[model samples]
Target: MSPLLRYPTVDELATRAAALVTRRPRDARLERVGTSRAGNPLLLLSVGHGSRHALVVAGPHANEPVGGGTVLRLAERALADPALTENADATLNLLLCLDPDGLRRNEGWLHGPYTLGRHFRHFFRPGFLEQPEWLPDGADAVTLPETRALLDLQDELRPLLQCSLHGVDVGGGFVELTHDLPGLPQRVAHTARRLGVPLELGPYDTLYWPSLGPAVYRIPPPRRGDLAAAITEAAVESTWFHPYRHGTVTAVVEAPMWGVRAVQDGSPCADPTAVLRTVSGTLRRDTQLLERISARIRPHVAAAPDAERLLAPVDDYLLVCPGLADTWDPDTDDGPHPLPPLGSAHLAALRISGRRLALRTAGLLHQLVTAAGSDPADALPELDRLLDAWCADYLDGCGARWIPVARQVEYQSRVVLDALALTARRADSLSGEPDWGSQAAVPMHRE
Candidate 1:
């Protein structure tokens, strides 16, 4: 168990961030930027004295926390290396954790030994709307309290770049860009390759989106059929989509909580439809199982304090996603090439997505059932064991292993550092000044 693999608690992160500013008081200061929906303070640490500003946010999704560690460590880097900060020439505005209310719920397993078993035992992911930094579908008029804090800062400062650090349950590393800056995709590929993290060649969530490069996808201006899946999600707007001032180009970095070798297997499948059948089967089975659980607990759901919020994910899974899966046909895609034949990796990624969705549904539903307490509460322990067994079997079948939090942090921070250098170079080029070159100028920051 490496210390890097152990995620810091929200309080501990705030304490350590404060200490960083205290030690380098002249260059850094910590302030409460805003409050969470649950009343937890959102701490933003401002580091360095650069003309431009770069906003780095982490923990936008409660379960994906590689960015939280990256934010803390990157703050330290900004304080210690003057040239690194001078080149990017931007103040590092670090939001240590964007969704503290949701993250606090996942702290049970964040403390260490990041095994699938422990994760299944302590897993908790709030519904899309309940997780911060999202606006409900067709309700762009609203902003989450946590997201409002970021928007307020973004509007006032208009930073040069914004980074949303995220991680996956299990898959390869990938990057999403709001703006297609030159040389960034190369930097991401090099970083993941050097760190032994496989790049995500498999596309599921990124499906139908344009690729900026290998494993790198452009987020906005959704490609054809993108919103078909978007409509199923309650809050589809993440942090990156909110920034506009200074044309704050955003980059979302994602790494896997556990590394799965299959994500990189892009070889052809003998019978691709067979893989789709497996995916369709898994989705229906998982949905039916959860529906049974819901039927048992329905009598008490209305009494729960957070019933509406907790039920959103279950409703989406039971009503929307499974319906699509049931009628989905490989022939539905009238593209130049067939859909399912995209290969084994694509199929594997689809299965991984389904399994993750099931886990999310089960995690949130159990919370709702427990809070609404009745005889259904007694059924939770057995339900948990069933999920645990499912997870254990899937982990083995997929050949997945725990990924150290350190590698994930390193990949994300290095990408930010290089992006800073590259963006600066582009700015200099426009001003008729010589290119500052890449991170090769700064030995300490190269991947």
Candidate 2:
């Protein structure tokens, strides 16, 4: 088995990672980021002597294991190479796995071709009170200890080029989020090209405003109080009145991993090692540009007030444009764009439907396991009951306009359940301990 497959458990990962680092002890620093809600410690492996703040965090959602795998592989290789860490003017901080509690819910069976497919399913739940993204009055209500650790580290070592690595399946190929940094587009494009990574621009993708013919989606402006109508209202209002904001960018990049995978997937050579080589090459090509971008932002970093002022509008805009889905366009090479915000009705309907679908799937799986006399079925019925309420709350009265989004939501539901079933089966096989819903419901709390 590959080294990637060999490291399964968290202990195994830590042990193997530490030994790999020992091969070149002088360059990098290995330290704990913080403990998870479930008492698992988050880890960061640093590379580079220069403290010119650069951060790449992965596993924020827990189920998204690809990002974690990519970051860990980079860390391991960087530790081995040493040059990645000992660069003259920049420091690289790697937050390998951010949400350990969420991660452990599907532990032991976290990786592989099969696992990746399952992970893409059931990975998204709306941000709740405990989520890092759920900020109430500018303060997080349920700040997981892991979140606190990340924030504390950010305060202690303010990074200039930070990447909160995440993935989406909206067909936005290799999407990147950009703040209003000078020369950002060119630099991002250049880095992407060097790495053979493709770009799909956002604004044009949604405006249905392609370079060529009529718009792909030419629905007339939605009527007042309509979901689409409200969404358009919000999008236009934010663009005009609200401080024109940019989100997910503090000199950040939101590269869509699967889109890049598509490039390799279609190629004649589909070897994992070669594919990774392509990925590393693409990343390494951008090394100097990243360093330059970091250095260029230094004056802004040094003058903390200036950086804050620059980012303030962006912060304001992001607040107004809730539910900003990432966008991409193949023709323009512009990279990710913020999708028009969904109106409250549409958004609510989508969430409720998703929740119900998830719960129903879980309940059905629980029934299967229990009937087989393999696992306890305590929470299955509760899950089913909750599913009905959630469905009622979100999906009941919405008219036909939401059919498409609802369809997508339903698709997402099927995928999530399928993946969870796979995860459960894998868990059962791994541990002699019988599966039990009584084993604390996968702590999904919505505030």
Candidate 3:
């Protein structure tokens, strides 16, 4: 068994964080922000008694819990050494897990024996509109308890620095920053290399955004009446950095669960247009398949008590994805635009989409089975066969290659710690304060 498989559950992580704060009562304080939709306590661990503060948020997406481990390690480090933040008069505010309801849905594969097959089997990610961090309109429409809690915290703390930890399905890690801090991208790249994580250089789903380095990118602010805005209205990143008036330098670290050499190869392609056409075609097929499956199960699911809530997002996604595919223009540019090389990252992205669709389909089907009061054996055999076949195909297409969980945590923690150190050093330099020895150095790996 790999050491990466040895990760703590949400309950265990919360208990551990509470214990750390309890042990270092003088330097730390623990507070419950609010309860999740599922009634899990959302915990915040505040370390150091400094005037300036940095907010670290983890586990916003249920599928990407690597941030949870990273936050725990960071809180522990801050508690052990007060000089890490006290020297700069800064406090470390850690949110252990934001979307506990989603986290609980994914807890099936989080404990041990982490495999790609098992991971996707229990995977559940709410649609973008359904997520707690971002919604279609301003969070003013936000009904989720978790989102409300986060908004309240942002209003109260108004941190100087905010770090949202996120992970990818496969390929290399990347950094997204709100502000162009000097030397930060380089430091992030260096840290990733030292931790033996690849930096994805190929065209990702968000390739339209300009890149600062191999994998580092500057997140563009959402424009009104645009797709980005429509998709991420009042997102946490934009809210914290733009209108919040806190001068918060927000950073998002997206690390991967697996890596391959092809993710970094940016070689010119023979025919970029053909590649775009192929991708567009795949999307069209997937959209059609989802529509067919939804239609088949709709009558059954409609009678369930929570029918609309369970099916609306999936329907919206199905509608939007096909429309996006229809709008793809492969010949927009006169000059050659190289196709993004197909790599492990590409495969991983496809696999993730397939798994999500399957999960949604299964949910609808399960509702149908229950509403009809049919025997388990009498449920739709055709739907079951199709789902089983899709899962097998997804696994077969993307070969098994897992990155150790410890390495993933190390990369995330180092980037976060380095950001803190850099922010503190900038403050010290401005104030003409002497640098604190050793505490100012950013370690390649956490001690």
TM-score of each: 0.89, 0.47, 0.82
Ranking by lDDT: 1, 3, 2
Better of 1 and 2 by lDDT: 1
- Expressed as tens digits, the lDDT of each residue in 176-240 for candidate 2 is 22222323344434444444343434212234221111101111221224332232232221111
Query: Scored by CA lDDT, what does every candidate get?
Result: 0.72, 0.38, 0.66
Q: Spell out the clash pairs found in candidate 2.
A: 47-85, 48-85, 122-416, 195-282, 200-329, 201-329
Model 2 stretches astray by more than 4 angstroms: 4-9, 76-84, 113-127, 140-142, 174-178, 181-447
User: Which pairs in model 3 have colliding backbones?
Assistant: none
Considering summed lDDT, which 10 consecutive residues are worst modelled in model 3? 332-341
Q: Show the colliding residue pairs in model 1.
A: none
Candidate 1, which segments miss by more than 4 Å at Cα?
A: 1-3, 86-88, 137-140, 222-228, 231-238, 301-308, 327-341, 369-378, 434-438, 441-447
Model 3 agreement with the true structure over 1-447: per-residue lDDT tens digits: 432445556887778887887798888888999998778988998887777778899988778989988988888777666576666466889998888877776777787566655565556666565577764456577778887888788878877678888877555677777666566677777887777787666434445566676667777775545443344223233343542466667788787776544555456556555655655666667667667766766765566654665565566567556544544335444212333345444434433443444445554454455555653344466555655665455446443256788888888888888777665566566668754313345444433
User: Which candidate wins on TM-score?
Assistant: 1
Please give the distance, in angstroms, between residue 182's alpha carbon in candidate 3 and its true position after superposition.
2.6
**Superposed Cα deviation of residue 220, candidate 3 (Å):** 1.1
